[model samples]
Target: MRMGKGKTKLMAAGMSLTVFAGLLAGCSGSNKEESSSSPKTSAASPSASGSSAASEQPSKIDTSKKVDLQFYMLGDAPKDLPLIQEEINKMALEDLNATVTFNFTTWTDWSQKYKLLLSSGQPIDLIFTADWTDYQSYAKKGAFLPLDELLPQAAPKLYEFVPKDMWDAVKIDQKIYTVPATWKEYVTEGIAYREDLRKKYNLPKPESIETLEQYLDGIRKNEPDLLPLADNQGYHTESIRQLTTKTVNSSNKVPYGLNIMYDAPRDVTSYWGSPQHLADLKMYKRWADKGYWPKNVLNIKDSGHDVFASGKAAALLGSENPNRFNDSVIKIKSLHPDWELGYFPYPNAKGFAQPVHPIHNGFAIPRSSKNPERALAFYEKLVTDKRYNWLTQYGIEGKNFEVEDGKYYKMIGDAQSNGFPREGMQGWAWRNPEFMLFEKSFDAVLQMFSDFDKIAKPDIFQGFPEDWTPYQAEKAAVEQVEKQYLYPLNVGLIDDVEGGLKLFMEKAKQAGLDKIQEEYKKQWIKYLDDSGIQ
Candidate 1:
């Protein structure tokens, strides 16, 4: 019931990054502190058999011992970070008898900084982690501590509140290394159109690919100034890929050479040469010829939805989350009250959207932490306790927000930007929607969860933690090959589609596409067999 509350609209900015954000949501939580909370008493210690007897025991925090925990997060330290940190520490002192410091890796080169942070093994108690943030890789490399034994003692409420399947998702080889943030979302590509434009032109509702084409054609013929569809940094291609191909379960990180078909045979195959890819390319090429999009779409550096928001375009394609609204769309609606936004949740008739991965973002203690017991105890309260969760997510009540009719409303002024407080990081970890304030799209977001539930399919390959170590060399070469060859082909920048595909295939072969396919096929088959999918 609280799942869709106060969700922020996510943008599909860069192609690879956008998809990854949707697939793997957790980033890092930051700072430096001693590992002071693990139980030194024999009564609280985990058994050598690794049984969860600790969960059955009364898992109470030691009130006598005080501790300090350092937390690291993904974004740059905000301007109001210190002010929020002060309030956070005050709450910690009262509730958990601990003080915490927070640090950040700026957005400029976040991935590299995140990698370095984990690989360097600094004294971090809790760090923000998610599938996208290389949580699996770090966990596998012994950078993170296995958390199965600690959860019951440190976070009993969370251990019970989080579903078993979700916990199963955070596991690598039957051991959980991270706590997953609970949220309800459906990651799918949808078509968004200016409702006023559709009404004016008497365009058909954008319910399917064919109707979407009709809508685009109507705009192309009627709207001289606006494009039928817009592309910023090749987003349409990515959106179309989700629509056309069934994503291979373990193919989130790898960009090329995995052949995955949705209609079964669950074996790996070359997506580049898949019939779906070819059909998508051809459809896009036709749209380009009809002037539905700009001729040089690949070079357009402006954000697609931004252009759509400015009323320069009639339609745009990007990722859609039912439980959230696009921030750009919200801002546009705010400025132009007459321009309403309408969404068609799927482009293809299949209506098959990827369910929101259960573990989008959450806190994790590193192997270097000395006080994981205290760290998780603090996190437990962060999610389960109302006052603590509000402070952690929205910041000081009087200063940052106020409750009216049991709903959070940000105080006007600097704190009221984009439905989030300027004083703190938007709730990133252990996010409890039950404590959240609703946005304008709150009703629609909840409706999306219902709609997607009926139409969406659980990814058959959801739990396989992809290990890319063996194919690193091949992956790197293929990435380069894609940049040089596939980019132009997919975006309609190339004149001869056949010639371009031939050259792309040739380069892919040289870059070890065949080997990549075999590896993917072998692993995929094993996973299918293990899962009893056949």
Candidate 2:
């Protein structure tokens, strides 16, 4: 299996240095010996993985045994705390009786970082992978180690804890290669419209994309100050999820976005291979031309929640979760008392699709990891322990949060406790959500959460092993084409819609549209062959 040993060494050395520098981050320092409880965060921000994740150090480590694990992650780096993390590290080492440490790296340019890490074949102990984030691509190139070999002892608890079907789904070439995180329910993207606007215009809540177009037309006819619809330019996935799915599966329990993870129409599905792929794109384009959606949505960065929240636009796209449904939409009720949030779950004339998978961006050991046992032991401890999970998920309970009738809530004022930024980090997204312990009371605030332990509908995509998609060149080419023409073409910013479509199709054709379609067909057929049910 070895090839060009000297070349491998040189490449590995280069990768290590590059990874450490690029991913290395400073730590938070504290003078006091903190208590057992975790710290708090100062303000609102997006969640990340490193600091908020679990860390454990045991009391008695066999220092005579030392091993290093290289860790890969997405987003920001952890802020070290000499007093905090050192104590955690010490405890984990003591428990396992082995010294385990990390060589940390993060991604700014994902494609470039992936290229470097996978090709150099670094001795990575753990890496974050996803179907959307080159998980399959890296596996194809031998960047990851098949976990089946290590799970027995190196990760026995994990071997026993993780679900079989879920793990099996991540297998590539007949071996389990990745550990997927389970996603929570109530994560679907739906169209949210202002009820007050509906009533004001004497319009009905949109039930289908056809109805939605009528509603947007109404907005253009009456609501001069507001956009008929609002959407994000760079985010085409949400549009696909909302406008296209639900016609197939109407269960109301599924939680997928559009383009990459929809599960509906019973007989047909796949992020990009769905039957309505062309229809969804064409629908958005039609809305764009009529000024029914945003003028330059395709160019917008984040979804324009702020505009919709402030009542500058009619609707915004998001999930049924608390933040999107209750938090964002309900907050508007206070501002416009008559305002109500309505769902566009089945815009394509059907109903609920399947839920998104438990998940797939998580840590797995590379063969290069000399200390995989220590690393996995550390991973197991972090997921199962109460102290570790609590700190990682909730910050400081009393400070970052406080309990009311045994329900967890983020704390507001009376600030005395050190904020989490001073202790660990924020966002532990890539960790195992199954092992994550949350006070059940939090579910009461959820908008449409089903009994997650018994998800109403199974994912059609769940455990489906997809072939490596070499769509990087296509993605690059599409982004380029969109950059020059998306907003203009969509908004009739161009002279003719038909002409624009022709031009766009011609460009996409050159970018290998047919080839991409053929590639997906090969994989889909292979998937049918392997599953043995078809």
Candidate 3:
């Protein structure tokens, strides 16, 4: 979920990991490349063929020696992870003569631990990698092993399974360092509001900022117990950006304090000084004075989604990723069925959206891996084999979930409450849409995905490799300034919008905003010229 920086961190903290261990039992399996459009049976065996043309190639690599591999992922380990891990280990040991030890860098201090794990040369065989996690920078630093030759030999089926474009997108310095996920998602921001309350109060549909204000006003007037808009330090600015500019960030590498207009991709400037931002700040100040959210919202560490789910808030604003939105809706519906929910994609206000980048989620083998071959081997099974995928992604099938006609998925019994919610194990790293099961009751969410698929455009800066090595000090200083000045203005904590904007811009300049912007423009223009985009 690209819930901006703050919500991403909070959600990361709330996410639970479940260990899934299962070995591909047999050595005989189809070498044919699975059709990307259709779901197929499990390729439950590892074979030495990278493509259909190479099907007759015999296995030459050895797996005679037993080894135990350590796999690191983010988030807290779920209570049932060990159970799933045990099952996965049994299968892994039987097939590859290896077992996996699932390790998690819990969200509280994951960034520090993640950096230390790579820098200290820990023998981590497999770890989750993503665009959001500085995958390109780490790859450039040689923290990961190049997988060009290894994939064809160790994980032949997976090599054939992933498309050529995805492989190309994850390449750093012309070498593949990560196996990007085979799922296409639209992670644009949106609002999820209480439909029942809207009907009760007879509020207008929240299709734009103006309509949304009316909705918030109705809720504030009718519901004293519920905050009209659930917000946190991370989401207020994101919400304003979504409702106002409706522009995607120019580069994830640069601080989000800079803004890039959708029509003018090359022009990057501080959003705090923008006319739209000033108007948004004024509107937010009005909302704040009206008590749309709590006065102490910036200090409220509770997730906005959690606040909405707990019935303390009338609306939740966040990324519209299908899994994230659907999961939240499912949880809230289960808790309070009477509170009908309605979703409005922020892109709807602008009539366009962007699909998530291919490298948004992926897996990489650390340079210090002692069993890179086995790690890829296990990962291959996890992605291509339905048995392994179902076990790892959705837990123990009938016990944790149920499947209808092998397409739709539904949780059973106390699966969610017991801390084994479907797809909670950072499964995005290996998510293959071909084998993914849709939630049974998520018709609205599925429709939203379909709608986005029609309107989503290719992100112009997709796969733009951003190297911040040259401006490390400036980057740190700018970020520190954002935390101090930008965040307060974001939540409308400042009474004078003009004064706050001026002060924030002044502080940002002092912190080297101009220097960083100069470099950002240079790199962005170079990327455009290199890509032959006018």
Candidate 4:
């Protein structure tokens, strides 16, 4: 699976989302107090007796009266989403007697728009949330309802659907506020190269960073118009940062500007100031000068895929989400059938810092939801029921997709042409064990995973969620300072790598990078003791 700016949690290794003030239900002014306390009719409603018995009773589920739930999700609203929603609603009416209204935060300014939508206190029953989408931050601020009691009661099926350990992973301060989607996910940072281009020009398949470099060098020598690689802004610089530092010990914990190194697993420090950062910057400068990437890469909004599809780029550098191979690569092949695509995983030798988890994308009930119980009920069926799953993920089976006896599911007609948008089904945020229908092209994707397994390193700190409350302010300030210089340095737009890095370090220190590091280290020590990670 590929992780991009929109899909992945933007890491601080030069790629981070702008921090925005989240809209907590209590802070909506009109519903300020109501936001903090559970609503009267809600599954988790507060009672004077201090008993959650009300929300924990499955008998309370009201299926007679029809209720319409508003679901907000990140990404564009697909053209055929309405058609899919209509079909899903019909099934819901027969089962839960509920309907759903889908709302979207477009890609243009999704991070900002997400904040505004949540902060607006719109009566959203369910919203797509993830570790990358500020789920931890929002939970700390009480933007979502605690689902521990209500889940077991109203959505017993769903409560049983997710494994207990998976449930434990989403807990913040011992309270569950989000439902982590259960996906059989395998993702890693890799390069997607044009296989045809390499063979046509007598180049070897890109198997390592060195091989990749040679391929790019060949392209630079032969293909004058097509860029060896294309980028947009920072372009998952963290992946390259990881590649350059495969030798350096870094933490498995999600990057937040600073963390423990592999060698000193207990110590916390700013990676921006590390030797790896400088090495990457210098190497990128050389690549940029040699015209590996477009000269105006920073200004180019198009993704490497788009650039490749348009015949302007040769390869893409990113975290490939295994699920997206068909949608991304197969679709591209349709346009340029002559071209063959191949993927080269990062740290290609052996092991990854951490495995990609499904919690990166999931669903959460907002505190503002009037029907949290019903929403979970609706969500339960979407994950467990085959009919609902197919509808949610692939739209009307015959219309959006078709399956052959021995072949994997394939998108057909308009759905194949125009992708079923992320918002269309919130498919990524749902449990997809039984729901995940394979694609014909999935063999290649699976092979890449099998190859990755040979060298995949397990991160001991994988499920430990860092509570950012103590260092939120310091981290935000340092992030802003890092943002200003990181982009330019990452893209090789800076004149001097050393000079720019020195200045970046200075500003980061002034912006409280040290304080953030200390807090992170303090928490990490406690986490180590708690998790028994000696």
- Please write out the lDDT profile of model 1 over residues 342-422, one tens digit for every residue: 876652445454554545576789988878888988777676666666666666666556654444243433422423342
Evaluate all candidate structures by whole-model CA lDDT and list the values in order.
Answer: 0.62, 0.48, 0.70, 0.63
| Model 3, residue 509: C-alpha shift (Å) | 2.1
Model 1's TM-score against the true structure: 0.75
Q: For each candidate, C-alpha RMSD in Å?
A: 10.9, 12.9, 8.2, 11.7
Q: What residue runs in model 3 are displaced by over 4 Å at the alpha carbon? A: 1-61, 108-113, 250-256, 414-416
User: If the candidates were sorted by their TM-score against the true structure, best first, what order would they fall in?
Assistant: 3, 4, 1, 2
List residue ranges in candidate 2 displaced over 4 A: 1-72, 75-125, 182-186, 193-203, 214-230, 234-242, 245-286, 289-299, 303-314, 318-349, 358-361, 366-371, 411-447, 451-457, 468-492
Q: Total backbone clashes of model 4?
A: 12
- Predicted structure with the largest TM-score when compared to the true one: 3
What ranking emerges by lDDT with the best candidate at the front?
3, 4, 1, 2
Runs of candidate 1 with Cα error greater than 4 angstroms are 1-82, 93-113, 120-124, 132-134, 217-232, 245-255, 265-267, 274-276, 285-314, 326-329, 351-354, 368-371, 395-404, 408-429
Tens-digit lDDT track of model 4 for 407-503 = 3566664333654632245467774443345555665655555455444443434445567778777877877876688778888888899999999
192-227, model 3: which lDDT tens digit per residue? Answer: 888998999899988777888899989988988778
Instruction: Compute the lDDT for candidate 4.
Output: 0.63
What's the count of clashing pairs in each model shown? 18, 29, 6, 12
Clashes of 3: 6
Better of 2 and 3 by lDDT: 3
- Tell me each candidate's TM-score: 0.75, 0.65, 0.84, 0.81
Cα distance off (Å), candidate 2, residue 41: 27
lDDT of 2 by residue, 1-534 (tens): 023553344234233222322221111111001111121211112134322322222322233565544556554434432333454566665666544343334433455675676667667676666544556656766666776766665655555545555565566676776776533333445677877668877887777656766777888888777776665543433444445544322222212112222331223333332335445556666766677665656555444555566566786654333324444543455467666666554322334433444333456666567666666666665554545545554455554544444322433232223344211232343333322323222333232443221233344343444443476577567657655654455444555555665676677667766666556556645554444323
How far does residue 416 in candidate 1 sit from its true spot (Å)?
A: 7.8
